[model samples]
Target: MNRTNSSKSIRLLNYIEEKGNKLPHPVTIFILFTFIVIVLSHILYVMGTSVTFEGVNNETMETEMLTVEAVSLLVPEGIAYMFSNVVSNFTSFVALGPVLVAMLGVGVAEKSGYISALMTNTVTKAPKRFVTPIVVLMGVLSNVAASVGYVVLVPLGAIIFLGFNRHPLAGLSAAFAGVAGGYSANLVLGTNDPLLSGISTEAAKILDAGYVVNPTDNWFYMFASTFLIVILGTLITDKLIEPKLGKFVPTEPMGNQNNEVSAIEKKGLFWANISILLTILAIAILVVPENGPLRGEGGSIITSPFMSSIIFLMMVIFLIPGVVYGVVTKTVKNDKDIANLMTSSLETMAGFIVLIFFAAQFVALFNYTNLGTIIAVKGADLLQAIQLDGVLLLVALIIITTIINIFIAADSAKWAIMAPVFVPMFMQMGIAPEVTQVAYRIGDASTNIVSPLMPFFPLVVAFAQRYGKQNGVGTVISLMLPYSIMFLVCWTIFFVIWYLLGIPVGPGTNLNY
Candidate 1:
């Protein structure tokens, strides 16, 4: 009977693997779904079945369209209107701008052997047993530089582990888990924090007259999440991923077996560290005081000069350290070399540029069709009707968000679509928009490791293939399955405990009954 049950389980697992591998590319699926949704929305609009919600007497109310023409299909109108107003949707375009610039700098750093040197030094110095967790933690933290971790650290993890006669895939899994799964849980705020917060703020205003969810609204929670994810990720990598990788047999032999840290690289690291500290100290002097140059008129963190010019701060942080490293390591012999590095980084963004073009169009078309808004309103209404408790509502939201994430992987875009609906609905139910945003972030972030729709998912698979040729999307997904499932479980538990304890999701945001 036991043998039979084991066989049944193996068959079931095989079935799942086959099905998952056969799934369509996420981007292609999204484009198809967008077209279908547009058609359905137009059909419903023409039938005069489309509803719009507005506030009346402190209660939410819906109004139906009277004229079929109001909802009618007007291809020419959509084309002309959407085409002419492309500039209006430029905010979506801006989302990809920083990613491109950051990548350009990172690409140069990678090409010049900065990342390779850094990894070699780090792994050699750290305790052998602790290397996997450390690499994972570093990958998670590297999200501040956008796609840098995905491109640089993940592959390095495999190479470094293989050099140590350990399972390379195990190291790759650990890095991928941190880079993708722990995306939103960074120690410092990244582009995503402000972007998601803006959407949440806009969504909150749909129900409340004056509502603003700060970008750092989930700062405290996410700060804690950084450590939690590291610990959980470390444990899983060591216990689950490493063991599953089986006995270590070198698949790809390393050309440079000498793992010794060179004096030049050591000097570069020290100089880079010093430059980073100096930069932080300079920023501190500017923004730490009430009357400092970087402080705003109101002396608030949000309104402060520091917050206003965070991108510049990021640029300085990366540029200064990178420059120092380049100089000390003799990688930047001339100004042309620095320019070439920046140029190289931008060159790597070609794929991303192509992706953003289609993704931007899809998002614009989606918003123009009013389908996103309609779904949000209707979905919110249905959830409202259930009268589920806060904990249950959160769980439901997480599950829904996770499902949606599988199809729509762009974090900002998904939140932009969801915020208008979920934020207001939760607010009406006495749940804070901040809490809702945090929940959305957690749900959105957790499944990224396993989802093919995620932009970096294919990239990781390609990286894995370098060490394991037979490894494809299926191999990558299967490996990350443990991390994804474990993250969702542990992350949800954290949320439940935080909610039950009535902890603040962010500075002024509370998780309450």
Candidate 2:
């Protein structure tokens, strides 16, 4: 029965990969997207296409009609902006800095042998039966640390599974699914939450001038989904993914020691934990009190320096532990060794650096020409005109967002353009801005693994190459597609049930205006 099931599953996945391989390279796709944007902008501009939505006055809190027009990329001013902003656009791109900075710290941990030792410790301590679920859970939680999981955990998952005489690809698929497929679900809020919320608030202003969507707007729902993803991810891996892979066969020699904790390594890990605790204590001192230096304006914790500096703090957190481990283990013979480790990590990002140049141009062009905005507004207008309301409308939005996510994977960029359309349109149906935001999150995150355009998709492919030298984009997508579909279906169901119960999506967040 297992072999028969595995054969059928393999055939289906093989078909998926074959179909996916027909698609262009991601870098080429983004480059082609720029041309499409340019042409579409010119055509729309000539047609004088525009949409009118209610806009709120920032000062007076009054609503008025705001006409959104598509500008021509071929226009003189547009040409000037495009040419002049090329360098700055790539340099200032949101994704470039976070991934690069985070990797530097991760590189130190990875290169100094800290990450390997930690992984060994974690695997040895964890019960074998709970490994899949725990890996999925960690992947879900990794959203809080930016791209750390994509760079670290996915590969780690494979190694962990291999140690237990299981097929490593199953572990890779599960981790990727939990990391990318469950990207929106996390116990602690991530950078994406603030970015999406800010856009939602801006869009909500069209309906209620003073309306605000906090970063924690979707916290309740997201927190719940974190567990849902772990469970679903685990079930899919153990039931479907693992069964299909059949057995473990190491294509590469395993270097990890099982349950063998060296005294030096144990001591290094202990002091690393101490450094982390001390840092946390110091941060708490600065942020916990009424007059804390990290507090926001009027003593707000959310908008404070501590919240704003999370990514930097993550880097610091990793750096301290990594350096401590390296020093104690003699992995870092000198300061130059630390520098070399960081550089080596950066070296692995060569393709990403190249890919970003194209992505930056495409994003900049899309923003300047306002094509994404027009499409979003048009979609919302159609739905509003049809009078699609309540649960049905929300479900439709999820499907629409999922389809769009295939070609566009930048969460913030998609939401920024989408919010101005969907938020106000949904508001017309008496749906709250926060609710619309949550629907978007469900769709956007669930489809990430299948999207070739997702930034980390290539990195995942590279990681897989270490295990199977010939594994390509198709293989990764095939392995991850089931999780993507399952997450979307299950998560959307949970969302609907939660909404029907009139549950608050977050603290003081509502489903209705």
What is the TM-score of each predicted model, taking all chains together?
0.79, 0.76
What candidate 1 gets wrong by more than 4 Å, as runs, is 1-80, 91-116, 162-165, 194-215, 244-246, 251-255, 357-374, 405-434, 452-478, 508-513
lDDT by candidate, in order shown: 0.71, 0.78
Question: Which has the greatest lDDT?
Answer: 2
TM-score of model number 2 = 0.76
Q: Against the true structure, what is every candidate's RMSD?
A: 5.1, 5.0
Model 1 weakest 10-residue run by lDDT: 64-73
lDDT of 2 by residue, 1-513 (tens): 123323565566456545665667667777777898899999999999987766555567777766778899898998998889999978865556766776777678767877667755665567999999888887887676556778778888887787778888888888898889999999877656755776676566555658878767799999999999999999999998888778766577766625455999999988887888987888889999988998888988766787666566666777778888899999988899889988988898777678767766776677667565566567667777887668998898899999878766777656755666688777756789999999999999998988877878888888877777767766776677788888899999999999999999987677987
Model 1: per-residue lDDT, tens digit, 429-451?
66888898888988988999877
